[model samples]
Each structure stands twice: as C-alpha cells, then as structure tokens.
Target: MAGTSEMIDLKSTPHSLVENFNLMKGLLATYGPDELQVLREKAFRNFTEFGIPTTKDEEFKYLSLRALEDGRFAPAYGATIDRFELEQSVLGPIDAINVVFINGEYAPELSSAHALPKGVFIGSLKDGFTVYEEVILEHLGKIANLTGKLGSTNDERFVYLNTAYLTDGAFVYLPKGVSLEQPIHLIYLSKADHGPLVSYPRTLIVLGENSDAKLLESYLGMDGVYFTNAVTEVVMGESAILEHTKFQQEKLESVHIAATSIHQSEDSIYTNNNINFGGHIARNDVNVWLDGEHTETWLNGASVGLGHQAIDNHTRIDHAKPNCNSFEVYKAILGDHALGVFNGKIFVYEDAQKTDAKQTNKAILLSPTATINTKPQLEIFADDVKCTHGATIGQLREDSMFYLQSRGIPKDEARGLLVYAFAAEVLEKVTIASAREVLENALFAKLKESQDMPEKGGE
Candidate 1:
C-alpha cells in the first residue's frame, strides 16, 4: 500500500484516468462522437457524488470502499499479459471458446476461438464499436439508467468514470436464427500488482430473434486489495432463447461489486444461474425486466460465504406485461463468521394481470459464527397476479443426516452428504452439464475447506 502522501497525490491526479481518457477520447474522436460527449457528462456527475461509502448507506451497509480511497489503483493500460498468467488466473478444463480480459482490456491473443460454433461473433466491445456501433449504442446504458438506481447517486462519478475511462471487455452478439450448442465463456481476471488496484469489466450480450445460445461468465482476482466493479447487460429479442451462467470466485483479498441486468421481449425465454463463491465483500444486484407477454424467466443462484466475508444478492423481477412468469431460488452456505444477505423483490405492474412470480431464499449455517439475512417481497398492482415469496435460514436437516449415517456413512460425511443434497436441488437446475460438474466440485471443495474452520458457536 502507498503512504498517505503517495495516496493523496495518486488520487488527486490518477495516471490511469489520464491515460484512459486520452485513449478513449482519441477513439471516440474517430467514432461515437455524440455518445462520447454523453459519457463525459455522466462521468463528471459521478465524480461529484463519489468519495467513499460509509456504513449508514443501506445499499452499502455491509460494504466499505474506504480501502479504495488510498488511490494507488488505475484502469489497466495495455494488454501486457502472458499466456501462462491467463491460465494460472482462471479456472480450467474449459472446453469452450474463452475470451480473456486482463484488467478489463480484451486479450484475443491469450483467448481462443477453436471451440466457437460457426457464425458466432465474439470480440471486444471497443472493437465492436467500430463495426457494430449502432448495436452498441442502442443497448449501452439501456438497463443501467444512471438517473434513479442505487448506484445512480454516484452515477456521475462511477458511471462517467467507467464510461470515459473504459477500454475493453467481451461483446457477444448472436445473429438472427443462429443457435450455438457450446457455451461462449468470458473470463475477467484482475491482477493486483501487490497494491490497491481496480478492474472495471463491462460485458454486453445481444441475442437476436429466433437465436439460441448459452454463456458462461466468471470473475477471478489475484492478490492485493483488488476491487472488481463490473456491469453486465443482456438483451433477448422476441422469440429468442438464452441460458446464461455467471460464476464469481475472486480471492479473499478482493472486493467485488457487480450488477447484472436482463431484458426479455415477447415470447422469449431467459434463464440465469449465478453462483458466487469468493471475495471478502461480494454483492450482486440482478434485475430482470419482463417486457413481453408470454415470456418465461428463471433466476437461480447459490452462494458460499466463509471467514468474515459478506455476500449479498439483491434481485428484482418486474412483470410489465400480461402472462409473464418468473421463478427465483437462491441458496447460501455460511461458514466461520461469514454473513449472507438475500433481498428479492417482485413487481407486477397494473397491466400484468396474469403475471406469475415465485421467489425463495434459503440458507444453511455450517457454524454458529455464520449469519444470514433474507428479505423476500412482492408488490402486485394487478389483483389477478399470482405471486409468492418466502425465506428460510437454518442448519442441515437432522433426519436426512441420520438416514445417511444409518446407511453406514460417518457422522460428518453423512452431514455433508445431506447438505449437498439440500443444495443440489438448485445445482441440478444448472443447464450445462460440464459447467455443472465444475460447479459441483468447487462447491464440495469449499464445503470441505469450511468444515475444518473454527465455528464461533461450536455446533
């Protein structure tokens, strides 16, 4: 970490900002002139409102950005990456097209396209700006309206900062009538240089009409006090079908804050599975907007919290038209003195007379030191809507554990087996078979790691 003087000087005049703006300004000067101006205005506003987050803010009650105030971090400049580094920083055995982003910049040289299905276009958002500017312009900031959301207060600062200083990330666009069997994977790796640095990864996905595809996105941060502020937006066109999975496994020394927005059109089907496993402070905000009638959406997630880390999942499902349906299930396994928070909100608009929504949040405390806070809510403006929301936090089922033990398994192994079964209900729902195996292995390993951890209450 830098000293007080060094921190002050760095924050006051960040080299990353200077380098990024110059590059972006030059890029925008060539294309997106109008959008560039708008981004500048947004950045100025964000800067005015952002300094550091305190405990009083409800959205940030469990997250503190004070560690970021030291100001030794900057948006990464240049690719400056090695293939070995990419392989070491990521979770492997991946048999799909891999797009790598080092400190938020796309690294095609390090990425591979050998597994991509024919006709699938995967490239950098910056490069796409030159070739697919219209699509990028049409969808950029469409979900993240910097005017009213939770992060909007500092929109000028963070939004503008990201927009003006942004360099690269994955851009996935499935042309109309295209169907991809293999998943397109995007990996965001944050390299901390043994100090306080941040990586802002921006991802955009567009599925055209009658298109079908699956996406696997993951985030992993190396040592040092790293921060991952990522924003992902997905749009599904009418009659399109998409299955998206996101896995976040940053290290314990990292702070991760991510926002995912999904928009579904008429007769479209969208499924999102998010599994969060790491990070000292991990918070994910997911918003689903059902704008078309006869649309179907599912939001499922499982999180594991250990040590003193806090993981929060805030989800919102909005039914804007009639005959839309949504189901949300989030499960958490808490260990040590960790904390898990789940807030699920379902909104049925007046016109959504036949909207159907169900939400459930469940948690299992492995140790007395673990804590879980869950709030499930439903707001129905339409009297004909059918909605249900519930939350449950408890230990493993003793009867199930006893059954396993009676079958000759040891006590601890039996307990673990039952716990795995409890969490498996949601895990089994993961669409990709290969990804499912990887997730299962990771979850079991995490459970084993926390099993030996000292329980605060010693159950």
Candidate 2:
C-alpha cells in the first residue's frame, strides 16, 4: 500500500489536487472495509498510473480539464442543506421514492423512507455492503469495466478516481418477477462550505429476470466552486426492463463529470435520457452493451450551454449478439460563447446479424461566438446488419422565425419557441410524465433567459 501510494505520479497531478491522494491514503489505512480493500487499492493504483486526463487523449481531445485540475478541491462531508433549498432544486413535483445525498453522504432524514416489496432493496451503498452483500459483490465492479481491476486499461481517469473513494452512494436491486410502479429519485446537493469542495457519487443497479423499474438521478448544487465526479453501473437480467434518466443542473462555475455503463441480457430493454442545463465544464460518458439476442437500447439527451460553459456528451452502443437493436438522438443549444460537444459511436459485431442501429446528433448555435462540435460514427462488421449515423450543426432557421414573428410572437419569444420545439423532440421521449414536464419547463426557462441571442445568422 505504501509503495502504491508513493508511486502516484505527481507530475501529472496538480499541486492542489494532491490532497485528494493523501485523503484517500488515510481513509484506506484507518477504517476501510475489509471486503472492499482490494478493490479500493486496485482503483487507486489505476489512478496512480494515470493521474488525470488531458486534451492529448483521443477521448478527451475536445474537452479541457484545466479549471478542474488547478483548483483546490477537498471532499465535502456532513453538509447541512436547508429543506427549502433542497425542495427548490427539483424541476417539478414528482412523487418518487426520493433518496437525498448532501455532499456525497446519504441523508436519511431528507430522503423518503419506505419499505419496498420483498426481494427488492433500496439504500445507501455504504450499508449495502452488508444489507445486499451477495448482490454487491457480484455486480459492483462488473460493469464500467473497472479500470481498477488489473489487466484492464481503457477508461476515463475520473472513473478510477471516483472508485478509489467509493464508500457511500445509491444502490437499488430487484429480484425476478418484481416491478416498481414509482420511480426512484437519487437527489444530490453540494455546498462548498470550507473551500472548493469535491465529491464522488457512485451507484450500482441490478434487475432480475422479468422485472421492471424506473430510476432518475438529479444533481443541483449551490453557487460555489465544486467538483462532482460520479459513476453508475447497471446490469439487466433476461427480459428485464429499465427506464433511466439523469438531470444535471450544476452551477455554471462548477465542474461535473459522470460515466454510466449498462449491460443488457436477452430480450431486455434499456432506455436512457440525460439532460444537462448548467455546468462550467460538464461531461457525460454513457456506454451500453447488448450482450444477448433480441435486446433493445434507446439513448436520448439534450444539453443547453451558456456563458462560456463547456458541455460534452459522449456515448457508445455495441451490438454483440444477433437480433439486437439500438437508437440514439442527442440535441444541444448553445449561446453566449458557450461550447457544446456530441460524440456518438455504434459498433455491430460480426455475429450481430439482423441488428439494427441508428444514431443522430443535432445542435443549434444561438450566437456567432457560440460553438458546437459533433461526431457520429458507425462500425458494422456484419453483412446483414443495418447501421447509420449522422450529425448536423447550424443556427436557427430564418423562415421559421419570421413565420412565428409575423403571426403574433415577439422575436425573443419566437426564438425561444423554435429552440424549445427542437429540443423537446428528444426530451418528450422520457417515459415519466412528471419528468417530461420538469424537463420541458427547464428547457423553456433556459431558452427564455437567452433571448438576447443574435438574430438568426448573427444579424
């Protein structure tokens, strides 16, 4: 342990970020759980091997980590947030099984407490080690391709960083033949009380055969400099179904990065809708694998970037078996010098005959200075598979704007309406009614605030 701690490459690590290494070392040495010691060490070793990601890496070519690396970020603990503030952060009133986390520590008092059905579990990841020992042991590090595990080398460095300090997070499980009528909401709130704060939020979800459930994860933090690095892994049994949504509204001055991995079995279905409204430097990496025949995957997302914020979304779906299908659609709205990026990839294996896959990404830039970078790729080795991918980047159409203005709407309102309709195309796919309402409200509000955007074509 001492050797590995000393081996952490300092050259690649920033001076202020070294405290995190020391913090992880102390936590592991003093009171780390016995069952997870090896996993923690392996994850730390991976971080030691590669401290942080830079633009030099192909995956991070367009995204920059300067703001996150140079800041002094210490893990925030026991943060006391007001009930009113917590309530206001939510986009809408959704009667969900709410689980609240204040600065990465589970807050039972703030969360909704209820007894789930038999063979189902919902609680913090810390207690889950004992409460759901067998399930945790089996699927904890299986998904996300733990870079922490030896002999593995492909992953964004933050995933390993989050794993090394993964003590508390949200965990949910369902046995065969069970279904959850109410969606589970994991709400995270962050405050930089002492100084620039840092928190790692981790999650693991497992679904048994023939079971179905819905999950939503939301993040909203106070106006301060902070970093939220999160990772979530999911596994679906044969014929299982899951509806997943992630709502991120971090303050534009903060740093946020999340990686989500999903594995689906035979006849299973998985759907994801990730919405991003605010963040100084936000990045979402979602990966899915269709490991069984007749499985289906759907991925949709929308991002609104403003005020120099850099928001990036990277997604990949792999068809490994026959008769599998996958679809992805992502949209973005950028203004006031903001930067938005979208990269989607689909891979169809040789054995994945009869596979169908499609991917599309579109972005609307509202200012001459605002920018959008999009790349859609498809790789199909199977001769009988159908695969296609495309991306489009452009400003608002003048014809539509004129039509709306000539009718009765103001220029700003007309622009907002046009942008809203474009983004709502993707958000409308969210299965939860309340969730869709919340998403639509947030999208319009974001669009409304940027009404001063230069006229179409930067008049």
Q: TM-score for each prediction?
A: 0.87, 0.92
Error of 1 at 265 (Å): 0.3
* CA displacement after TM-score superposition, residue 145 of candidate 2 (Å): 1.0
For model 1, what is the alpha-carbon lDDT of residue 112? 84
Candidate 1 lDDT over 181-255, as tens digits, reads: 777888887777655667778888999998998888988765556778788889899999988889898888788
Tens digits of per-residue lDDT, candidate 2, 98-144, equal: 88888888989878888899978887887676677878878876788
TM-score, candidate 2, is 0.92
Model 2 Cα RMSD, Å?
4.2
Q: Candidate 2: misplaced stretches above 4 Å?
A: 1-18, 28-33, 146-154, 451-459
Model 1 misplaced regions, further than 4 Å: 1-34, 50-52, 69-71, 77-90, 114-119, 146-161, 451-459
> Each prediction's Cα lDDT score?
0.74, 0.81
Worst 10 residues of 2 by lDDT: 146-155
